[model samples]
Target: MNEKTVAGYCIRCNDQGYLTDLEQWNREIGLEIAEEENITMTDKHWEVIEYLQNQCKQGVAITIRKVGKSGVVDIKQFYQLFPNGPLKKASKIAGIPKPVSCI
Candidate 1:
């Protein structure tokens, strides 16, 4: 298993840069990822991030349309939150792999 550091802790990540071990995730790590993405974490952002993480854990496909139906936020709002590519960036911040539909 490949290892990467986050919040000063060595953790595992997949080839595409998503955290391989969800157990290694934490708010500080998420904040660092959000910062790297040039996004400031807000309550709304946390809600969306957590939602996406949950979706990932459930093995559900994630997309703008799917998130819109989640009632957490509509597609437009998702864009406003994550700016340059909502699903992709948000998933990254959530420590979930880039969804298959992302690319």
Candidate 2:
């Protein structure tokens, strides 16, 4: 486990930088992570992030196809929102563990 300060809070994270403790996450931390990922948060982006976080809490396996089917955003738009690696980037910003489905 690695500890890093984000949004003035020291949080535990994995080697890949995904937060290890969901309880330690907040919107400010998410914003900082999004900035690090080079993404500017829009309401749409927050919607996706919320969706991802909720799914994670529910123990739902997150996948691009699932997110696409999720009313939040389609696959194309999800890609557009996060660019290079949507699932990985979004999950990171959402303060959830990196999905097993992600490479």
Query: Which one wins on lDDT?
Result: 2
Model 1 backbone overlap count: 0
Best by TM-score: 2
TM-score each candidate: 0.89, 0.95
- Against the reference, the lDDT scores of all candidates come to 0.86, 0.94
Where is model 1 more than 4 Å wrong at Cα? Answer: 101-103
Tens-digit lDDT string for candidate 1 (3-97): 88878878788866678778789989999888888999899999998898898889888878889999899999999999988888898888887
lDDT of 2 at 64: 90
Itemize residue pairs with steric clashes in candidate 1: none
Worst 10 residues of 1 by lDDT: 94-103
